[model samples]
Each structure stands twice: as C-alpha cells, then as structure tokens.
Target: MVSAWVVTKVAYVVISIAAGLIFFYVTSPLVKSEKKQPLEESVSLLINFVLYIWVGKILLNIDVFITDPLAILAYPSDSDAFYAATLLLFGNVIYKVKWKGLNIGTIMSSLAPVFLGSAFVYEFIEVVMNDSTLAWGHLGLLFLLLLFFLIFHERQSSVATAGGIFTAWSLGQLILTFYLPYTTLYGYMMTRWFLVLVFILSMTNLIQNKRLRS
Candidate 1:
C-alpha cells in the first residue's frame, strides 16, 4: 500500500494538471496573448498558471506556523531566523529596502503550519530542509514560479511587484530549511498544498459566475 506521503504527492500532480486546464479554460483571453509572446514566454505563462496553485499552498503553510506560539518557543533556533534572513535577502534583491526591523515580521509570517499542524514524522519536519531532494525540489519550484511570474505580466511595474512577492516567499522557504525541524516543515508544506487546492476551487467558481453572467 502507498504511504500517505506518496499518495498526497501523486494526488498533487493530478490536481496541478487539473488546475492548469482550468486556468487555461478561464483565461482563454491569454490564448491570443500567447501568440503575441515569444515561444519561451508563452510556454512559461502556461506553466505558471499551474504553478500559482502550488504557491498559494506555500502561503497557507506560512499561516499555520504563525498561529502557534509554543512551537516558536520550543524550537527556537533558525527557522524563523532563516525566514528573517531570507526576507532581507529578498528585500535586497528586489526593493533595496534593508531595515533590520522587518525580520521579526518575516518570522511571524512564516510560522503558520509549524504551529497549527500536529503531525510529526520520524523526526522534525523542518529537518528535511537538510535533505538534498527536498531542498532541490523547493529551489526548482521557486525558480520556475518566479520565472513564470516575470513572464506573465504585461508591464514592468507588474513584473516588479511580482518580483518582490516571489522573493519574500522564496525567503520563507529558505528559513524553513535552515531552522525548523522535520515535523514543522512537513506541516508547512501540507498547509501550502491545501491552500493551493482551495485557491484553484475559488478560481473555478469565479469562472462559473462570469459564464452565468454572460
């Protein structure tokens, strides 16, 4: 029998494809835009519609950690610190804003799933940050997401806004890897995927509403 982890991961791939088809169906306006874009750019826009589903999940997971205070006190090391550092990294990369004050805010924001989800693996979930496969998967997902965002927007201002948001998010993931244990990390991840599912459903609903209106 497949473990829950294997089952969820497999389910995620199927859900992502479904999300993609729905995105394409709803944003058919973009089909015209695709022809006007560079071939690589067009491919990226399509892929990113699917990726947004995943990113929404990450933000949800961040919320999970924030709601739990004891987890922060108990696992006081680097997870929050790493998020703080990554926020700084993002600030420096995108906005050139480098106030020391924001690290706390970043830490608070990254804490959602760690505090809320009680599930634990053989070890702390954040510990998986040290795992090569996990780290690489996050990095790959982040890179593609950012790339897709950059290509999605029509204007420089929109791209800049996207860059800032993407940087902060990627930084949050970096924090999770360096500080939190395996269990916290797993919770964070699960939270994100759940959020992704919700977001896709919401988007689908909006499309149905518009079709009814027309």
Candidate 2:
C-alpha cells in the first residue's frame, strides 16, 4: 500500500510532467521554423537540473541516501541543494553556448514561450489545489500577455519578443511586490533581480535589432 505522502509527491511530479508536456505542445510551432522541438531541449535541461539537485542532495546526506536510496525520493531535500542546482544549471547553459557555439538566442527564444506557459499552468494548478488567490491577478495576467505576444508576433525577432515578455513580467512583479498583499522579503528581492535581468535582456535585444537593421 502506498502512503498518503508518497501518493501526494507522485501526484505533484505527475502534474509537473504533464504541465511541461502541454507547454511543449503548445509552443511547438515557434520552434518548428527552425526544425527544432524546444520542449525536447527543455526536457534535456530539466534532466540535468534534476540530476544536479539529486546529486547535491545525496552528497549533502550521503549516509542517508546510501542507506535508503529508494526512500530518499519521498521527501524534500535541503534548500541549499535547490539553489546550488539552479546556479549550476545557468553555468551549464552558458558553458554550452559560449564554448560549444550552441545557438543561445534561438534556444532562449524557443524556451521563452514554454517557460511562461508552463509557469502559468503550474501556478494555476497550485492556486486551485491550495485554494489560494494570491497570484491570479498580476502574475497571471503577465503570463497571459507573454503567451499572447509569443503566439502572435511572429515577425519580431525572437530576442525582442523574449525581452518584451521579460519586461512585462518584471513590471508585473514590481507592481505585485509593491501593491499586493501576502508579500514576502524573498519575493521582493527576487523581483528586483528579475528586473535587472529584464534590463540586460532589453539592452541585448536592442543591440541585436540594431545590428540587423545595419
């Protein structure tokens, strides 16, 4: 007999997988122009991320992981593992693109729509499951707008589209941080960092478009 906790964890993982698949399916056309399946790349990246996290977790608690390899899957690990995995994921992407000459912009553009779509689905599911109304207004609207632009603005450069979406998202986060209830310190800081990223992306997009025009 499966325990309730195990069932819940399994359900969450299933939901995450389903959400990712749906996101990939919906954004298939964006990558079709390049004869690519962005979701496949996303899944590969995700696998690397999870592998990093799992390894970090195991290394952090080697004795427990070694003793009960199967049992470790049922519980959440340390936040340090999550943070470390996230940093390493970025590093891995940068290493691949910068050193290996991977098409970074194309990958990012392919990923942009799927990112927002998956996020919207996951957040909506969380809201429904938790019966919470915190993120429905601003963040949800931003995701919807991002999806709309990515779907309709096929003529624009992918970098521009991605930058526009990130700008809108940063603006939304800023508003949510200031004007909304249920705000936390971590959320506030994270929003600021997102805004910084938005600025960088916007500048890069501007330069890219300018070069294309010249």
Candidate 3:
C-alpha cells in the first residue's frame, strides 16, 4: 500500500512537469524568434537550481542517504535543501555575470514571466495538497500582482520590469508567510530573505548601469 505521502510526492512531480511544459509552450515563440541563447541559458540555470536542491537534500541526509541513496529522491524534500540550492544558484549567477560576461538583468527578465507561471502552478498544487486556504489566497493575489506589473510596466527596460516583479513577489510572499500560524520554517524564511537581497542588488545594478550610460 502506497502511503498518502508517496501519492502526494508523485502528484508534485506531475504538477511540476506540467508547469514546465506550460512555460515552454508559452515561450516557444520567443525561443524561436528572439534571444534564443539567452532564453536557453536562463532555462539551464533553472534546471541547475533544481538539481542543486536535490543534490543538497541527499548530502544533508547522507546518513540515511548512504543506506538507501534513492530514498532521498523519493521522500519529501526539506527546507535545508532549498537554502543550499538558493545559495548555489546565487553563486552560479554571480559567476556567470562577472566572470562569464552574462547580462544578468536581461536574462532574469526574460525568464521572469516563466518563473511566475511555474510559481503559480506549484503553489496551486500546494494549496490542493495541503488544503490551505491561506496558501491559495496568497497565490491568487500574487498572480494578480505579477500580471499587473508585467502589463503596466511593459514599456520599461527588461531589467527594471523584472526587478520590479521580482521584488513585488518576494515582498508579497514575506507578508503572506507572516500571516501563517507556523513561521518557524528556517529554509523558507531564508529563501524569502535571499530574494529580498537579490531584489536590492538588482536595483542597485540597474541604477549603476543607468549612471554609466548617462
């Protein structure tokens, strides 16, 4: 008999794949017509981010991991894994931006909508699995906010638009998390703070770039 937890885990993978497919479908035109390389790189980064989390999970639970290494892949992931992945993602992005001469803002902006789509899908699935009204409501409001920004700020530079949306999403998530009864999830808290930091740094970069242009 498969445990409910196992069922939920399988459901999550299905939902995640569906979300990725939807994202790819929506971005198909852009990939074919414009900035194909940048889009591909952005997607590669996302893939790396997930890989980091899975690898981190296994590393964190090495004791059990060694006994049944594949078990780590089967069980529900931990917040620590998220934190580890976030750190690795940030490090990799910085390296690419500085050492590899990548345009961080443009790449991030190109991927912003895709990121939002995936987030919405994942959160929707989470709400269904957990039956949490707060989660559902938060995701609903978040979707609206992202859409509003993407539309209203469409004329802005990619960096500015992406930064604005990213900042808004992170801040909104912070507020929503506060309303939750249990807020002691360190990994979640760390992830939110890291996002806030990224937003700040991105804005600063934009400002500096603008000044240089001027």
Candidate 4:
C-alpha cells in the first residue's frame, strides 16, 4: 500500500509530466512563428526570469541564514508569480499555440482547482486533525503560493506553464503545510526542479516544432 506522502509525491510527478507535454503541444504553433528573436532566446528569457523568482527564496531559507518575511515571500511569490509571467509570454509575446490536444486541455483544466483546493484543504486538515503543529503564517504562505497563479504569462506555453506552475506551487504548498520535523526546504527544491523541467520542455518543443516547420 502506498503511503499518503508517497501518493502525493507520485501525483506531483505525474502532474509534472502532463504539464510538460501539454505545454509542448500547445506552444507548437508559436515555435514555428516568423519572429525576429531566436526561439531559444525567447524561451531562455522566460527561463531566466523564472529562475530569478526563486534564487532569493531558496538561499534565505537556509538554516545558516535567517530571512525577513518579505524576503521569504520573495521566493515563494516568484514561484507563484511565474504563472502570471507565462500568461504575458503567451498572450502578448507569442501569437500562436496549438490548443487542440486533449492532454493539454485536460491538464489546463485540472490545474487551478487542484492547487487552490489544496490550499483550503490543507487548512481544513490542520484545523480538523490534531496532527498539525505548523504556524498560521506558514500555512498562510502556502495559501498565497497556491493562489499566486491567478493570471499567468498567457502565451502558447501558458497551457503547459500554467499547469506546470500550479503543480510546482501546489507541491510547495503541500510540503509547507505538513508539520515536518526538519528540512523544510524540500518543497522549494521540488518546486524549482519541476519549474525548470517544464521550461526546458517548452523550449525543446519550440525548437522541434520550428525545425519541422522549416
């Protein structure tokens, strides 16, 4: 039998895979566009910005370094803020995306509720069950992280990035919710890895799509 922790981790991994593929398919159209900037450059810009989001949050969370709330929020917010950035990328920058795939649609559809709902449910569990020892602000931070995805970059990659961001933030939310004894940074690590992976997938899809189109 799979433990709840294992189950949650597996679900996140599955979400990551789904998000990566969906974004790849959705961004296919933009990848082949007649744009002046190199496709890699465009994707690289997105990736770099996304990386900047977490660099502070990750470092400050270290046991060796104590951080202010604003500083703490910076990383968490960046992780959540990434979704909003994706919206701008897809909406303002990229003009096209193949939104025909069922996988993409399904992934996009399930993402919002999953992350947001997890926030509420986490609180509910903390209140209802006696197992929770986490502080309210910590839990509240999770809520903020989960809801941070309100408006995303909204480009061809939005479908995948939205889901991917949601997944990553959701994992962060889940980990932060738990009353862990030590090493609270695992959630952040997991979130960063997923975001990086999804970004890479988006870029790869663009390159492949561009090549095939040419």
User: Can you give the TM-score per candidate against the true fold?
Assistant: 0.26, 0.69, 0.77, 0.30
- The global C-alpha lDDT for each of the candidates, from Candidate 1 onward, is 0.36, 0.62, 0.65, 0.42
- Model 2's C-alpha root-mean-square deviation from the true structure amounts to 4.6
lDDT of 2 by residue, 1-214 (tens): 3456546644655565567557656654544555354666767776787688777777777788789976665556456666567677878888878997766666666656655665565556656676546747644665677657656657777666766666666566656766666322111124455455655765676577658767
Per-residue lDDT of candidate 4, residues 1-214 (tens digit):
2345545543543444344334443433334453223333334443544454444434535553354544454323333444444444444333333543223333343333333444445444444453544435445654564445444434434444444454555455445444444212212322444445555654555455446546
Give candidate 4 misplaced runs (Cα > 4 Å). Answer: 1-101, 135-138, 151-161, 167-214
Best prediction by TM-score: 3
Model 3: per-residue lDDT, tens digit, 1-214?
2356756655665565457445644644344656567567767887788788888898899999999976777776667887788788889988988999988765676666666666677667767767756566457755786666547554666666666666666666566666665222211333556656766875676677567657
Scored by Cα lDDT, where does model 4 land?
A: 0.42
Candidate 1 off by > 4 Å: 3-8, 20-156, 182-214
Where is model 2 more than 4 Å wrong at Cα? 1-10, 13-17, 30-37, 55-81, 181-191, 194-214
TM-score of 3: 0.77
112-179: candidate 1 lDDT, tens digit per residue: 11111111221222235335444444444444444554354344233233333334444444444455
TM for candidate 1 is 0.26
Clashes of each: 22, 0, 0, 13
